[model samples]
Target: MNYLTVLGLSAATLTTISFLPQMVKTWQTKSAKDVSYIMLITFILGVSLWLLYGILRQDIAIVLANAITLVFNLTILWLKIKYGKTRPRKYL
Candidate 1:
């Protein structure tokens, strides 16, 4: 592997694995109230695009990284929607 490729893979590995902690935490707690729906939605969209780009360009690093990120982010998004509850009006 070339130096540039190694560097890119390293970065991709780190960022992709970094989501593990959050995924495990959310899985265990089954709560994602602190997570932002807009952020997750946009992130999923961006990752999906990146995955497509990687496929078109035949970039393994980008494809692998975005694939993992997409799965993690999707799980979190699903959990957030599943656990989130409707809020009632509160008059103070």
Candidate 2:
């Protein structure tokens, strides 16, 4: 493979690895109250667009990186919804 492709793969690997800790932490801690809904949603949207762009451009690096990142972010979003929810208080 060419150096550029290697570079791209290296970049993709690092970015993907970087996001893994958050996924693991969220899963282990089961606490996502601190995670922002807007940020996660916005980031996911942006990543989705980037994935589409990569597909159009036929760039494997961008496609793979963003696709994995999107899944990670979506998992976090799901964890946030599942763990961050609180039962409403009842008043007698």
Candidate 3:
């Protein structure tokens, strides 16, 4: 791969991986009240747009990165909705 491609992929990998901790925490604790609905929604929208842009540009790096990030964010959003009640579900 070219330098630019490597750079893009590396950046994408790091950014995407950053969400793992939050995802795992939400999954285990079943609590997402601290998470903002607006933030997540807005980010999702932005990422969706970026993904579309990437697809249009035919940039594999942009497409792949945004696609994976989209999934991560979506899953987090789903968990936020599912476990966003007043009290966190106890972890066993």
Candidate 4:
């Protein structure tokens, strides 16, 4: 692979993996009040667009990263909808 491809993959990996911590935290705490609904929704939309763009261009790294990001973003969105109204724990 070329240097640019390697760089793209590395960036994709980092950005995609960054969502994992937030996902796990929301999952474990069962609280998403701190997570902004608007932000999550906007992010999901952006990521979905990126996925479509990747599909159009047949870019593997973009497709893979956005696909995974969509999943995480959707999960967070769901959690926000489900638990956004409740008061979350102070410590978590």
Candidate 5:
């Protein structure tokens, strides 16, 4: 509850939750045609590192946001692996 912590939480919430839309869309559509596999892989690695950093530092905001982000990223990565190479129209 200090002002800075509140700001931290807000920032964390926004940045973290921003990944949700992409995850849900990919999950529902099962299409990641436009999403870069390289980007997803790199982003996942970065987030995982941040999650580890958060755990080491005992930072709640970092931990919570990165944990949620990890889930979404993993889902998107899975979808990409499962569907990225196939014909999009076939799925539709």
Candidate 6:
């Protein structure tokens, strides 16, 4: 593999793995009150777009990273929706 490919794959790996801790924490705690619904929604949308972009570009690294990240983002979104109502809202 070329240096650019290696770099892309490495970046993809790190960014994808970064979501794991948050997912595990939300799963264990069963509390996604602090996770913003808007943020999750926006992120999921962005990831989806990135996945499409990657597919168009035929970039394995981008496709794999965004695809996996989308799964994680969706999972967190589900958790947030499931647990969101139980928590009190913050009004500023």
TM-score, one value per model? 0.87, 0.89, 0.92, 0.88, 0.87, 0.90
Q: Give Cα distance to truth, residue 5, candidate 1, Å.
A: 1.4
Instruction: List the candidate 3 regions with Cα displacement exceeding 4 Å.
Output: 90-92
Q: What is the per-residue lDDT of model 5 for residues 43-86, given as tens digits with 9 covering 90 to 100?
A: 98999999999999998888998998898888888898988777
Number of clashing residue pairs, candidate 4: 0
Report every candidate's CA lDDT: 0.88, 0.89, 0.90, 0.89, 0.87, 0.92
Candidate 1 accuracy as TM-score? 0.87
**Candidate 3 displacement at residue 24 in angstroms:** 0.6
Q: Clashing pairs in model 6?
A: none
Model 3 residue 15 CA deviation in Å:
0.7
Candidates sorted on TM-score, descending: 3, 6, 2, 4, 5, 1
What lDDT does model 5 reach?
Answer: 0.87
**Candidate closer to the true structure by lDDT (higher is better), 2 or 6:** 6
Model 6 global lDDT (CA atoms, 0 to 1): 0.92
State which candidate has the highest lDDT.
6
| Candidate 1 lDDT over residue span 1-92, tens digit each | 89878998999999999888988887677677788999999999999999999999999999999999999999989878877864333458
Evaluate model 3: give its TM-score: 0.92
Ranking by lDDT: 6, 3, 4, 2, 1, 5
Question: Model 5: what TM-score?
Answer: 0.87
lDDT of 2: 0.89
Q: What's the C-alpha lDDT at position 34 in model 4?
A: 79
**Predicted candidate 3 versus true structure: per-residue lDDT over 1-92, tens digit per residue:** 89999999899889888888988998988888788999999999999999999999998889998998899999999999888755764657
Q: Spell out the clash pairs found in candidate 1.
A: none
